[model samples]
Target chain A: MCTTCGCGQGEGRIEGDEHPHVHEDGGGTVHSHAHAHDHAQGPGQRRMVQIERNLLEKNDAFAKINREQFVQKGIFVLNLVSSPGSGKTTLLTATIDRLKPRIPIAVIEGDQQTTHDADRIRATGVPAIQINTGKGCHLDAHMVGHAAERLNLPQDSVLMIENVGNLVCPSAFDLGEAHKVVILSVTEGEDKPLKYPDMFAAADVLLLNKVDLLPYLEFDVDKCLDFARRVNPRLKVIRTSATTGEGLEAWVEWIEVGAHSAKVIRGEALSSPPCRA
Target chain B: MSLMEGMLRIVEENARDQGFGHVRTVILEIGKLAGVEVEALRFAFEAVADGSIAEGAALQIEEPPGLGWCVECEKESPVESRYDPCPLCGKVPLNITGGTQMRVMALDVE
Candidate 1:
């Protein structure tokens, strides 16, 4: 029950204007979305049950299922996260253009409305599926699970999942991706890593995009790196410019290493027994 | 629909498992740094809880303070956000220890 135009008020249409209703778990998200408080309250005394369970447990459960699917299918999934207009879509297109032929690649794009990003990925001649979260601010594992199923990414292929542009909520939701790559443009505040520490801590890598504009802007690269390192000591930082393709090579190398490592791990798992997380 | 819906679904399933048809109150434990807006969650509950076990449930939110481990001070500090400098050392990026929780801690059910 997610509406595209109006925020989460109703379900949204899919890519084309023709066929809509591609929401995840619409079949039974809640078997009783139409549940009205019609049941009689017959001496129902309130009692407390200490559930002590995270609200994202359901999403994490779906994420585990997604992780298993990725492992079994040997697909390398990368969740791209960033603030809006951080040049996430541009980076995805550039990455796709560089790596699509070398290794089979497919993209799952998330946005509030329209098929713009998905259409851009498709322009590079790769399968791109757009998931409109409608009023949802982030892409949860449940949605990604269904999106992956629909994309049907090939074995040993790279699956880039561009999360909805928001550094806040996306950090908490795991989409079963091998890694969460967070992009921060130089134009944005250099202290974002500190400001949004959860996102920095959750991210596996930080892409400092729009580095070409660094010369013009007062963005302090060193400070940003220091802040990122402070938040996550192990976070790998990469500077990139999708327009000039300056740091795309190093980014490509990083992707290749990640994809290869994911494949190898999947291979090892296949050779041995699967380890349940 | 992603988070709150999932939560209500679990609550309903729990109600079925425990034979409680009605939820009187939902005491949600949300950390200050949990990145969730309680107001939005309440809105989601209003939208998705209709006819479910939690339809008429009262939402009681418990916001626990954020806990963080400071490296320089080598101590745990109460942090409201990651941006908050270490309470002890005044250093940024304290490892979050608490207050990032987004869970159903306790539910007053019938």
Candidate 2:
């Protein structure tokens, strides 16, 4: 399976690439070195070159650039991740309704295919851009960088990136956000944390959504929280329900605190002189 | 697929920098806690690297065991899963200290 999408190994086509195929090596070597000359020096003709670079080094570099830009602009960015139908959009719209009066906000909505979520966000009177991943599952740092550039996100504002609806893929890709918020609804199984440990482990906050429906369900809240904590000890959880407007205050306040910190960082950066080494 | 493409891009970049025409093998150091599925990576690499400089290149993965520092036992223990508690004390969450490596350690090029 592809870690980014959970698609079948030999089935799905990755972005900008065709299906896996073998090609004939038709003697394309341009070198004219004598094989016997190096044969005495090594056992094989292949030379070992050490790189010692991280696999995500390229993505991390892009993410670092995005992070620096966000910090400089005092933008508090949150990468919202969750399974589909976890009320991410509903919660986001509700949260925006509350925060928009006080703070400037922008959104980047990612989906496999749709301008619908972005349209919904725009309906809330905020700037939003939709990134259709096509066959891709998660939004990578490169895509986020391009989207951020296009959005021209304002300073001292909250930037919400609603990632592609998948509990698996988004956990590995960091989009230079200040935090990764994972939302799990009550309709889902409580053992989700244990089943998808990577997503729970990667998240800083877990929004236990659809708490309003808890009365009609057999979902164990304590067990769910415990399971999430077992995967990630410091994961802050907020019981939220967009329909009932429950826990919206705490969630909004949490965003405010983060946004305030970003503004403070910007203030400090403005006051300090650039250091030269 | 993204990871495989990233690895191929790195290889291509290094090929240009180091003056290598073809890659024979790509060595990776993948930790047990790196969240990478090796089988998936291997499957994706064939497609991602096809017709590229690393086409037909062999993937060699070196898996390192996950290590966690148990606060209750005041010792480090090998942990297979992240949710596992202190193997020694059987209580409290163990602080993950190792086995998150996901690096392209080396390459065999010609």
Candidate 3:
């Protein structure tokens, strides 16, 4: 239900039309009532109005605001996107544990419904907020902006936004992060990158998680990396396994470098105004 | 159809601004690389346009071919996806010049 206006979605409202009714029971009691609507839509009433606006413009506008805030605060924000059961949450938990002692950290977890992931992150002793995007297949920039408002992120901290577990819709929406880390597990098909080329093309880095399971599975790690590169030549890839703690240090090092770079860049931007900031 | 929802919002807002009573049709210019399925969009318009000024509205989509700029060839050409190497030079990366756009073009309103 809409808070400002009672015209909630799914419940149709008649704002400009009305249908009135009256009835007299033979007992001399008369009743009158009216419901809104007039369904006589004629062909001649329709007129053309030009719009010509991009569908992603609204979301991108909000993303720009979030990006500016992150740059100002010097927070290294990484948007984690992947298909369901790709071990994003597990990887996040492991990474947080490895880096929480050295650098301040916060998390914004996105899921269709449940605080399950957020609960796991909190157990690791870092502040985490869960955004339940009910009926929303993906998280937009506006939702992330509202979530960031309440996150109370510290300066020079790392903000990891665990995006909803979907590869298609999340590929188009930018949540204003320094990098979008797309995680693909060995369990999934190596042909996934070729099938979902849009997701691979949009990603800055592709994480091949669950590498520990490579020996047991028929998944060809090299072939998958080649497919990812074929889609996006500039994609930086890292192999990791959250369960066995393999490649976890490299992932942490990667984030630490990003966080440190964000700090220095933000400092330089402060001393001299950013060129296009 | 989140893209449809975004387009519908703009359509309805434009109707309100123009003092139109209702919308009859919405014309969209969807590029090939917009990552939207034309069949799915036509089906989803029935659901996303419900309860708004565009309820029961007709959706007319115009699809444009995907266009790309080849850095090696220094020419613009048509390509399906970013994964496709440049047709002219067979380059690894061809910068996208067009397509991948979902926009609301015009609305037929009352």
Name the candidate that leads on TM-score.
2
After superposition, the stretches of candidate 2 with alpha carbons farther than 4 Å from their true spots are A1-45, A275-277
Model 1, stretches more than 4 Å misplaced? Answer: A1-42, A274-277, B70-75, B83-92
Local accuracy of candidate 2 as per-residue lDDT tens digits, B1-107: 77776677678777766777789999989899878889998998888778887899999999999988987778999999788889778875678888988888999
Q: How well is candidate 2 docked (DockQ)?
A: 0.40
Sort all candidates by TM-score, best to worst.
Answer: 2, 1, 3
lDDT of 3 by residue, A1-277 (tens): 2231122222111111122111111111111112234445444465688888988776787688899889888999999999999999999999999999989999988886778888999999998887766556677776677567678788899999998898888888888899899999999999899888888888899889999998899998888988888888899898999989998898899999999999997898799856674
Q: Measured against the native two-chain assembly using Cα atoms, what DockQ does each of the candidate structures obtain, in the order listed?
A: 0.48, 0.40, 0.48
Ten-residue region with minimum lDDT total, candidate 3 chain A? A20-29
Q: Using Cα atoms with residue i matched to residue i, what is each candidate's TM-score against the true structure? A: 0.86, 0.87, 0.85
Off by over 4 Å in 3: A1-46, A272-277
Model 2 deviation from the true structure expressed as Cα RMSD, one decimal place: 8.0
TM-score of 3: 0.85
Q: Which CAPRI level is candidate 1?
A: acceptable
**lDDT scores in order:** 0.79, 0.82, 0.78
> Which of the two, 1 or 2, has more TM-score?
2
Query: What value does the lDDT take at residue A214 in candidate 1?
Result: 82
